[model samples]
Target: MSKILIVEDEDAIRRVLKKVLSEENEKFVIDEAADGVDAVAKIKINNYDLVICDIKMPKKDGIEVLNFIKKFNQEINVIMISGHGDLKTAVEAMRTGAFDYIEKPPDLNNLLTSVRGALKAKVVKSGIKKNKSSTKKGKYEIVGESKKISDLKDLIVKIAPTNAKVLILGPNGSGKELVARQIHLNSLRSDGPFIEVNCAAIPSELIESELFGHLKGSFTSAHKDRTGKFEAANNGTLFLDEIGDMSLSAQSKVLRAIQENKIQKVGSEKDIYVDTRVIAATNKNVKKLIESNIFREDLYHRISVIELNVPKLDDRKEDIPDLISFFINLISAQYDKKNITINEKAIKKLSSFDWPGNVRELRNVVERLLILTESDQITDKDIVKFSGK
Candidate 1:
């Protein structure tokens, strides 16, 4: 369900908005305000998913309300309703952080579409914020007791307090992200945001905008101004996952951002300064990439101030029993099932198989076995059948 606010001076318009929105979606909880002053008061007192306000209102206009809400709660989406003559003001409203602008004498479809889009965008932004917060809850706590794990934790504790860049080397699914989060959690800028960008996931053509942002009208499809991860993570950490997959051109820009704590958005000449700690992780050998000239050596040197290597699941076989127990408890809770036990024979069999997908693969196998096994105690037979042994 989405909570929405309708701020308009005219009673008829306000009532019409409420009726249209309510009829469109029963889940929408719509609130009305006579003007900007009333809207601001309501905004402060309540949490709303979207706010639609008329540009010309008595006492406090929509622009004032937009500015106040942006300063207080940037997460809340706003849509400005303006008269045909207020087109200039509407554009200004967008510049001042309104999600979008709609001409007055509202078309039902246009109003509904803009509101729906704003709500969907709010949901995505909220999800990202939640994910970031959840990732930060225990940035330093390494969840293992093995000697290798303990040593890594100790190293992280010692190195995390510095502004030094860290290069985390590990195999796929080896918890490299966990290591990166630990460094950020323990760093001097722990309170600041920790933004993550997957270099491999972003297309090479769009990687620049993803990192440094883009100006309005910077390129085709750039309908409005956008902030990049670098700007968003100012005074914080930016974790670049799969850095080895980043293109040569993107690597140069990354190098510049590290060398000088400044970046120029695509199609913009002005440099935006950011105080960000860069932590990069890769499953591939960066040195080999440099040797092949696919990855820039200078950038590698800039980001590799300190390097931490996470061992693969095979190398950490001693931790298998503990890992199995941990997964069983975690999976059981998540699936709403009672905890299952792993027999000694099953443990031995698991230890023997080479986990090509590392810890993630192990977790999946555990969940599968838990679902398929008839007995509460998992044995070698269950492992063999499920694991394709």
Candidate 2:
């Protein structure tokens, strides 16, 4: 059941909100508080999913309560209740971290809608956070018995036990990230956090603040203090995916962190020491980038103490059958469908195709086949039709 707190000084309003929410959703356990002080006290003890707070109250106001929630539990959604006079204050409450505001004499429909949306968002963010923490053994398990795979597994074992930084090189979707995770899982920091950052996905301006945190009020949108990836992955592994696409400025900050074992947050001067293992990956060329003056040669040398390469899917066609079987079982369970069998002819057709998108691409094709196939078994015609280049 989801817990919610209703903070209003007026007893009638608080009682009405409690009744409305309870009638709307019997699962929501709503708690009422007459003042901000009582509200903060209850919040300290209970893990409330959502908080509906009034702006005006005796002793401690909604702004103070909102600020308190932002500092202690940033995930909790707080919705402000504003009177006609409190409209401007409600707008300010948003900047201070309240999720959204509803004008006083709350509209039942609008209130329910905001509450439902906030609770849904909370569930999604919570699920994503937990999904990031996977078991050590299963997450990095590589399938197949081909010579190329065997050689790669052997290389992983050799480097997994070391503290040296590793740089993975490969074509797009060729399992460079799996190699990085395997190294982390096999290393001494297996029990610690395995934080993965896609350098290419982050915007150029905010990359620094992303890797190293920023303080509240550091910028226009920095309403609350945030923790960065480096700090999050302390005493653990930090996987920098697509390092080739990172900005030159961000690269220099990363170099300092790797070299000195310390990082400074974007708006702070204090250097924080982080005992993190760096594993960087990219499909771009270090030599060409260095020659072009886009990438720093010194940083490349710092990150590439142990270099490893992942082969393309087309180069490992012998493993396609095992990969197909693995995907059938995994995808069937995920989608709640029966696992389909593929004949030798179908396997040959899949193996014959040039998988330019590599292992990642193969998985997508398998999922598509699983969802679209008419029969209980997969065939060459299915492969030909669904496995489009």
Candidate 3:
């Protein structure tokens, strides 16, 4: 259970926040404080996983409370509640160590999503060890025992200790990011930050700035000096997902960084040397892209020092049952539902189909079934009605 403290001077708002959280998930053990002074007192005595604090408060303000927490326990995530007038202060509070901020009369959806994300990140930041033998799994835990998965696990164990760059190839939703995360979590540099960038998501024009950062007035929207992924990931791991989608110009810059462990800001001549481990992943066939002149061959060679291919669901269907069981437990906890049982016929039916979207699709189907099905047991009919496969 996650212990959350709702700190608000307003009685009604505090009550509403507690109500929303408790209704969303009973597992949230919530406490309340009327003002920042009480909040600081409670925080001093209580171990809270999250704090929902209003930006404007009596006695002590949210910023002061946030500073206290940052100094007291950096692990505790604070979500600032902001009114219209407090927006600027809220942003500053975020820079001051707030996890996220929600506007007044909080959009419940955004509030809940932020809460979940903050809690999830808290787990990752806390560096909790995964129980390899248990069904209760971390988001990045590799959950399978098939020959291919077994071999993949073995390879990760072998390569994780080295500073070798890895190129992970797989279909979309095949858990490529999970593999990248596992590599970082088990590596010698596990204590450092793990920064991830989706090359495909950013525009080609901004990709360079996104990776290498920019100085004040570097571009039209470059308001101030910004740190890029390469710099942020210094002395850690930088995961470049969908490298196949990266532009040739950006690819050349990436190659330079990989070859020389140095990067330049977009509007600066100064070189910043960093000891960052690069891990790249792509769903596309990189070699074909190379032949088509879309991806750089030299960059490819540098990143492919250790190649790891995450198998698609069809290639590892034998692991579906295990995956299903794992997801059931995972999604159940996320939704605050009791663990539901899946019949053999349901599991068999699920395994029979080719999951075009791979493990990701399967998890969605499981979540769907858990929500749509009325009974505690999930069967083939539930699969038929909800799986959408």
Candidate 4:
């Protein structure tokens, strides 16, 4: 049911409008405001789908009420009730954010039609807002029972709802990008696009064009119009992986983009607006980079609203069992084999060694074990031979 507020000083007209609205739609929950002051108070305190206010009121006029409501809550749909002689005010009210206008001696069909149309518009607007918010959320799913993994998951849940920029720090195979994805998935903009750019992978010369885009014929190889990552991720997220390796010049542009929420294409004179949530990840110590004068201090601050440190494989050895099991299942399905079980001795042997490449390395070992082990049940000797334990 949609909530609606009716604001009019006269009790007779207020009651008549309420009755007409109620009679027209049984689903509408109608509330009455004696004057503009009361209407503004109700609008602030309650969530109303629509507000219908008379042009002239005791404390404040309909125009004031309309302007106030729009400034406070742009989502609320409003309809202005004006006297026959107040047609000019009614039109002005529409320009001031009123959904529609109706003459004071209200026509039933006109009032009903306007109310229905306003409600429909409100619904459509609300859907767009919801979708925009969803796009900013990232997608990351890491299942584990280890305390470190569990704590990371808890942290992500707490931080994802906010608009804070995050910097994920971890080793190359420690799933830093996964954590970044999880943060985006949980954020308000999850429904928006999740654009990933590997800074280290892009060539230094082309990094600017890749990130901020460029106009056609701006450069020798420029063949067509292109939108940059920032533009593509408008109202969404931009994940910068291996940020520590980004070139100094690119760092300057990135810093500007983060600070201004705007980007200028490499060859274009025009600046494009972007509402993007930034999630940066790096395997190297950004602090060390800053000390070495490789990373920009200003850019680091711009992206690090919150920092998440992903634990390495050796740091969380207790998780080996679960990780091993997960990989076994994953590889078993890929190799078209029945779910295989590993012996306790084999798990112990696997857990005893230091995983230099972290979870990714462990997964490869599991796949190797699956391929080499002749029996359905993997033994310690098989793990030792295949994993080179």
Maximum-lDDT candidate? 3
Q: Give the whole-model CA lDDT for all candidates, comma-separated.
A: 0.82, 0.83, 0.85, 0.81
Error of 1 at 290 (Å): 1.4
Candidate 4: 10-residue stretch with minimal lDDT: 130-139
**Candidate 3 C-alpha lDDT tens digits along 1-389:** 99999999988888888999999999899999999999999999999999999988879999999999999998888888988677557656755667667778886765786687678757755774323331222468998999999888877765564456789999999999999998888765677899999999999999999999999998999999999999999868999999999999999999988766779999999988877889999999988998999988878867886788899999999999999999999899888887678999999999999899999999999999999999989999998988887
Q: Model 3 misses residue 301 by how many Å?
A: 0.6
Per-residue CA lDDT of model 2 for 120-171, tens digit only, reads 6567446543221232347567777788877777767545544567789999
lDDT of 1 at 377: 90
In model 1, the clashing pairs are none
lDDT of 4 by residue, 235-273 (tens): 678999999999999999998787556789988778776
Write down the lDDT that model 3 would get: 0.85
Question: Which wins on TM-score, candidate 1 or candidate 3?
Answer: 3
Screening candidate 3 with a backbone cut-off below 3 angstroms (N, C-alpha, C), the clashing residue pairs are none
**Which digits, one per residue and each the tens of the lDDT, describe model 1 over residues 328-372?**
987888877775788999999998889888888888889999888
Each prediction's RMSD over C-alphas, in Å, is 16.4, 18.9, 18.5, 13.2
